[model samples]
Target: MRGIDLFLTLVVMLSLGAVLWPFLFYPLILRMLTTRPEQPGQGQPPSASLLFCAYNEAVAMPEKLANLAMLKRRHPQLQILAFDDGSSDDTAALIAAQGDLVTLVQGPGRSGKAHGMKRLAVRARGDVLIFTDANVLLDAEAIDNLLARYADPQVGGVLGSLHYLGEGKSATASVGSLYWRIEERLKDEESRTGNVLGADGSIFSIRRALYPDFPDSVLDDLTVSMAVIFAGKRLVKAKDVIARERLVAARGDEYRRKVRIAARAWHTHGHLRPQLRRMSAIDRFKYASRKIVRWFGGLFILTGVMAAFALALRIAPLLAMVGVTLALILLALGLRSKGGPVAAVVDILIAYAATLQGVFKAMSGRTVTVWNPAKSR
Candidate 1:
């Protein structure tokens, strides 16, 4: 029993390390070894479509439309399309008000983002499809920068960086903002080496010809990125292209978003596993090591907790107590720290807690039906 406890603890710790090291450390190593490639010429720009899916987003419609108009001015050939997903608000009317400047799609009811995207895709006339969220403000050069990456035939998709606006309004929002920046840096490094695991929904561009239709329940951006990767095309990140948005200010907003994301990720795992066997050994290893383990981190945490409890009763009570004490101290420090090293530590703890919650919910056979939309940050 003692041997079993020790072994389980070791396994849990190693699994945690394997899951986080690639995303947090390998990127830094890649940056040291890589140099940015020269920018490709903007030579005849490809026809592109700007796609936005709005659900009760009337409050943001005016600014979103103005931003699209600005983008059209820069890229004269760009076409804009907006979808209203059974919004209870004035979103449909707002899109209709834009007239020819934007093509409007209305749905009988809310079918979620994946359905809206597919509907827009069917109507898209551009060779390149760029998807942006209603809440994001795209920089004037965002589309130009995104399309420029297609100059590399090896690159099939490009993901843009998201800058969190209004971050300083609250501590939670500030922490979220910092977390996003760290994520972007890690993704940029992953792209420099080869392929990014996935892209944010706010700003990612893909070839319309390569787009795959996915179930509405799955996370649309992740499904799109994985589909492209499984097709043997590279999905790269465009750090120069920026989309800015405010952090959702509410405390529970992040928690709700994480839960839905965890559920979708769990679902996507099975869908993506069959394709993994066909990928290069490096990619296969990277995906399993970095992504698969993290998805199961909550299980490991529970295992670790169980092992600690068993070991305390059977053998080293003092050591077990010390370990628990240390964990509490770390968590407390994390909660009190501003958005820096301490806050980052807190983010990790919060992430771990959320992961644990997801695992518990899954184990209890609880169907996660309540889709709490993320607060705009």
Candidate 2:
């Protein structure tokens, strides 16, 4: 019994520590690291290719391109390319309607985002490649801001700050939005330290030469940014170049999106490990702490809860009660948008089950190549 008690306590401590490390220790350590100012914007603005990947995004593409066109007018040297990844909808027709103003790559059929991006990359003929999603509205000066950072010469990529707009007044939207706020801040800190782990797919720019036509199974932004890091180049965060998109309002949709992303993350990591191993000790540590730990952080929380319960059974009932209470509070906060306590609890449980399913799929070597665009907010 004594042995069991000690073991359970240690397990609980370690598990909970994993959960708290990113929220507490990770940020604290980064804050302590002196903030490095970005290299000043230099030379002429690099000729840029504004690239877009679309699949069944007809409803949003027209508006998105209008914004891009405006951007093109501002920067006469900018080239625009749109790849329609075999959308069944009128996506191809819409791109065609843009005339010669935009180059359209309508592939054979349903190849997926990675393939679409690959096609776009081959067609892109610019010093810089600006990748934007079909739903994002880019600011007119986004390209200028991103290009300025490239003056440092060391920076291989620039990740733009993307904010969520129109997250309804729902409690769930607020929670999701707040979570992004925390995530973005952490990313900024990572950038300041000169070791950002990934870029946002919504809007980011990379030196054309550094771009890798990564495998279709890999997450584009992560692999691209990490590829830059692997080559001994810097990936900086450009908060001034902003883009806005609607938050995922439906809980089910949000859960599915997270699970799909989590599975892809697991797949991508296998390909990343070899590159990561060759990195400097500090770079390796930062990647593990920032990416690896966060990827499996949910598991840590799960383990902590189980260990706490086991400890409570053997040693203190209050331990289990406290764990349950905290969990209930979290569930309550998560459910605030879903309506009552019962619905929120149900959604939380569903989310957990979905997460477990995603992990299992990942472990089984399954990958989600096809994707459904989540319903707009």
Candidate 3:
């Protein structure tokens, strides 16, 4: 009975820690509350490169290029590079039609986004490299807002705010959008105080000198941003600089994305050990709280529930009943096709499960480099 009690206590503590780790951003929040808005930079604009990777985005490519063209008008010094990762669609032709307006790189087949980015970097001439996706729409002032932080010599990267464009009033979309809001708020605070663990892949910029030639297995956003932090440079936020992308509408698509992200995160964990040790005390804490704990948290949740059930059977039925009831509620929502508060709970559970699978795959020497864009958007 004593051993049982101890096991239950350990399980509960682990579960609670997993749940509460996100609140670690609160201190950074307090710092932001005391700070004032920064003035815009007055220095001449540095040579900047806008880089993007295209898969099969023929329909969206023209509009995206138009936006970049307008941005180019505003900042003539900006250079643009586009790479088509073996797209079977008109993506290549559209890029070819751009002529001298854009520099097109021959992507060596569908070698995945990380490899494509590495290839593009070799040809980038700008002191600052802005990486983004083809699907996201960037505001005209986004570049200006991002470059503003370069005025500070220590700032190595700037992450732009990502806002999700809802397809309709679906509950699933709401849940995903709400999650992004919470994530962005945490990132905002982290950027205000120190460094963001990673940047929004839809829109982020870093100094060309700080670029890490990450292997194809790593997530570009997390790898590059963390590399900046590990290099003893700060990453700041430009919330006014916004990029928009449509939210994935289906729960299954969302699940797959979480799985892919988790798998890459697990890969990053092992690959970055040396750099992790080089991190400052505060940055180390941030990485552990933001990345490590969350990756393996699903196991804690599962263990906590099993232990709670056993304890309830022996001595605490009421607490066990409450846990069981909540679990059922989440389970039912997860099985459903619709979105709501229950669906949100279901999404969280799915994410936790994906994290477990991702970690397991990573531990077993499995690596996932190629990606299939979810069709649910």
Poorest stretch of ten by lDDT in candidate 1: 364-373
In model 1, how large is the Cα lDDT of residue 133? 91
Lowest lDDT 10-mer window, candidate 2?
Answer: 343-352
Off by over 4 Å in 3: 6-10, 24-42, 167-169, 316-330
Q: What is the TM-score ranking, best to worst? A: 2, 3, 1
The per-residue C-alpha lDDT of model 2 at residue 300 equals 80
> Superposing every Cα of model 1 onto the true structure, what RMSD results?
3.7
Report clashes for each candidate as comma-separated counts: 4, 0, 0
Positional deviation of residue 253's Cα in model 1 after best superposition, in angstroms: 1.2
lDDT of 2 by residue, 1-377 (tens): 78988898899899878867876788898888887676666578788898878888888877887897899788877889988888889888988998667899987887777888888988899999988888899888788888888888888888899899865544445556766787789889989987687776888888999887578988776787788888888888888999988777677787888788778877888878888899877677777787677666668868877887887867768876887898787766656646554544545455445556676678899978667787745
Question: Which regions of candidate 1 deviate over 4 angstroms?
Answer: 1-12, 28-43, 305-347, 356-372, 375-377
Clash pairs detected, candidate 2: none
TM-score of 3: 0.90
Q: After superposition, how far is residue 363 of candidate 1 from its true place, in Å?
A: 7.8
- Residue range 1-377, candidate 1, lDDT tens digits: 65776786686676556555656655555667555453465456678998988888878878888988898888878889888888887878988988878999987786777788889999999988999998899998888888888887667788999998888765567767766887788777767767778777889988888898666666678888777788878888988899988787555676667666676666656556677678776566557645666667666666766755665655777887887888789778767765556656566556666765764565454424224345454
Q: What is each predicted model's overall lDDT from 0 to 1?
A: 0.75, 0.79, 0.80
Residue clash pairs of candidate 1: 246-377, 247-377, 248-376, 248-377
Q: Score every model by TM-score.
A: 0.84, 0.90, 0.90
